[model samples]
Target: MRDQEPAPFDAERRLSTREAAELLGVKPETVYAYVSRGQLTSRRVSGGRGSTFDAGEVEALARRNRRDGSGGSGGGNAGGELSVRTRLTLIESDRYFFRGVDAVDLATRHTYEEVAEWLWTGRMVPGITFTAPPGSVSVARRAVEALPEHTAPADLLRVATVAAATADPLRFDLSEDAVLGTARTLIPTLVAALPPRGHDRRDEGPLAHRLWPRLSMRKDPDEASLRALDAALALLVDHDLAASTLAVRVAASARAHPYAAVSAGLGVIEGPLHGAASGLAHRLLQDVLEQGDAAPVIADELRAGRRVPGLGHRLYPGEDPRARALFALLERIPRAESALLAARDIVETTARHAPLHANVDLALAVLTVSCGMAPTAGETIFAVARTAGWIAHALEEYGERPLRMRPSGLYAGPRPPQPLPE
Candidate 1:
């Protein structure tokens, strides 16, 4: 696929406070307020003290504030859906790109670590290795072990994140290199700490290999399965600004440490509408495997007044590219044939019955069941893969003005009566 041409950057376009206010439908005071809040950028006039706002920056801010109802604008949407600006990933033409590089290409061609570095820094660094301190891993493992017997994988991951953060003295550094370096070590540490597959070596091979044992119950995973798993992880590395990614950015905007920002992301990831959707989809796919037909199961779901899991996405009108890419990889694996067939049938049925399409969650469900992984395996993949993304977003947020995500509130309750103390 051809890359979309990016608009050229222009810094020469300048606007006076009056011009900016006129464009934004506000007074000069509001424009200056935006500048003071770091929502817009302004520079001093040549050899003069007066400020000149960047017209391009002002316009972009105006558009966002207008949409989100934040920039001296009236109350925002009732749903509070926010419009965020990001350079991490782009979803266009039913496909997503990491910093302009097609994700599908990267998934098949690169490893998770390589794509992660590309997301964090526009350039990929060669021979980059991710390893955490033994002490940190040990602490994280103990924390994981302490969880209840029925604890979910995501819950364990949350506890482990806190434990790892407590052990890392350098986590306080918010610099790009420092935060990214922490991510490098943190990812490996998290993987190493999970319980390994019975037959696989705990300390060998790539990140995907190391993670396979922890997620799947099957023994002796093949090379093809591992490769597909790697692709899935790469594809999930980032996708525009997901809810969890936005949470990470919000935490980072407050100058939180990388670990703190990641913790914030993990909090949102456990929600049913976010990462947990994959687990729910896994259960739905299990029904498909048992019944061997998608039509009945889909019909039953609709009859029961339940929305089918992993069937549609808001961003991709026709089909999710990530789902399409991963499903192709799954079809090639001999052990995954049955599960892949089940997933395909559901996709076809959904398309035929409704205007819905398969999403990455459905693809992940097929992969999990086919590999004999735990029901929560899909969410595990999501959380681990998205750690790379969350940290990358944290890095981006750190470079911006601190606390920039804070939005003004508009009260809606009944007005108070006259003061009683008067």
Candidate 2:
């Protein structure tokens, strides 16, 4: 009667709202609801008597609804699944503790290695040496060799990790403890294998002993400077999930290897807004010393309504814990009189002039420069120490799903279209 109706091809045919709902296991009314809610797109057909939808669009909507936990059998959705939220440990809080010990207390009382052990192994061991499997040593050696000559230990670390991952066929297995052990082992080893300096002296011990030779300027180690460096590293270990840590977690969520994940963290730290703050701090301190008084410099800066570098923080409302700890340590060290006076003057003037307090960066800059470390080394030393935190955050991210961190925003721009030259 209707010119012999053509045979229906199930594979290529568009789906009607009713058919789409049936395929999605939902009622036609639900499909209309989706359209009304702008969750699904539909096309008007036959003078708007009915609507047609692409089969692919229907499938995609079904997948999204399922992911959002809004769709499935019995009118249930996967979107309702409980997602685990990460607990952020900030530096300012009294409740923030590591390995059952307060971080502020640990930074004051422990060496850098001790703090590293605490973070890596979740124990407050007096000393710990991270050990890699016998098979991994050759890979580590090869990685060390492949790095460019004169590379800093920290830079070599970035190269070594990529090499190690490329060499290891079994690197992708997701064992939490195993990966952490590897990180603990690799970090100390990388520190030891950095490009050797002629003036550096070797000493007896594990991590520090191995690192001592690479960082020394004479056959005998500078005990005072080394002690200062140790305290500095311990203090810089972690500072909540700042921007750089967030970047590390994001990369880890993509199932990136530990090295790649840390590399992501390093990239973020390289920016001026984050880890480079210490470098700025170093320069600011140099200016104060060169100008011969901290009050005038800080006072003029405050009067101009410009924020001084190495002061103020988004987290610490009153003061930086690391700053207080490091400053206290610096006070007891011998022959630090000029630097100590400058720091005291700066602190008093800043307190009198502005609400901002000295952060860890300022204190660290004074300690490092006063100990004769090169200006650039301030940031490098920070990276070497903060690696522990980056690895910890990365490990935490690995346990979570590969949920893309796509923050939504309004799409305001030029309006959609008008005939140009009609």
Candidate 3:
């Protein structure tokens, strides 16, 4: 749990507004409001990229809010009972399901776009393809290109989504048909928005083929590698109310459009403990391969007091089903042999101490490393694939009563009549 949160702060420590928001259980805008009210002091980074707040001051303000009886995003109701009803996906034992069918089966047996389309409409359309409009692609690419070169892949996707939304006059239409239309077009737009690597860019094929160029620049993937990537996308399309999916559901509950709902989800996916995990795992695997052993690499990580990435999941004690599904596919890719062995070495080395099993992030790292994709490629794939799931959840939330997800916060502060601070 400590690893899931921002690092602990000292008096002089600085935090980005996003970091401040996570600490205070509020949005970044609320963090700025604290600055405006003189409750916190903020400074602009030297390059004028963004503002940073004093960590100690932010901590003090958080304490004050708790003392004043104001609840925050992390709090639950007094009874502590919280659960949301959903028909999209279910997880029990070690396996998961989508719409009453085995998710692993769907991922292995169908194309990614086919799985995504079925998740939205509850019916399969064989040989289905989603294409982005030229106008949407144009605007989205311009917006993405305007960002700093160091912008994360997920951040690029977020910017493209907002820009694409601006071009759609019917963005607010919550009708099933319209949202479905948004789903089909918006996904391809996201894939197309990213700068392509290979010269063989085409908008006409399986989505995995289109996405391949964005993640890997030099190498055109083999047939087996392409299949593995497709399966990976389908396997990750949705999980039961992941943090990002919950954000999407909440935004949908507020009547935000599908694009906005997905944007909200994209916002949550970049957190260290979430979408970035695969990137970390990818780097870790690179180190292991370079070092010629996982033992020392794992030792150094443990010595640094860092939890090993790509090992163990809170939701699964024995094995992660997604990892199992992906690893099986990776075995068929001959080029993945070395990375696969490294992954096995990692799991076996770590298990001697903590009994941790490999999770999907490790499997994803194997694919990326083998295919010569960047460290961030796994996250980009995750963001692209999960967009389908976010839209499905947004569509689901649009059906129920609005604001149904507003969980009550348990106040832990003094009585309201307390004297004002001097």
Question: Sorted on TM-score, highest at the top, how do the candidates line up?
Answer: 1, 3, 2
Question: What CA root-mean-square deviation does each model show from the true structure?
Answer: 9.5, 10.2, 14.8
* Candidate with the greatest lDDT versus the true structure: 3
lDDT of 1 by residue, 130-238 (tens): 7778899999999988878778767788888889999988889877777877998899888877766576647556889889988887777788899889999999998
The C-alpha TM-scores of every prediction are 0.83, 0.70, 0.81
Query: Global lDDT for candidate 2?
Result: 0.67
lDDT by residue (tens digit), candidate 2, 252-367: 87888777777777777766567777766777687788899988787776788866778877767777877887777777767566776777677777877477778888887887
Q: Which segments of model 2 are wrong by more than 4 Å?
A: 1-84, 93-96, 131-157, 201-224, 299-306, 415-422
Q: State which candidate, 2 or 3, has the greater TM-score.
A: 3
Q: State the weakest 10-residue window (summed lDDT) of model 2.
A: 81-90
lDDT of each: 0.83, 0.67, 0.88
Better of 2 and 3 by lDDT: 3
Q: Candidate 1 at residue 268, lDDT?
A: 88
lDDT of 2 at 296: 77
Show where candidate 3 strays beyond 4 Å.
Answer: 1-81
Candidate ordering by lDDT (highest first) = 3, 1, 2
Model 3 per-residue lDDT at 262:
94
Candidate no. 3 TM-score: 0.81
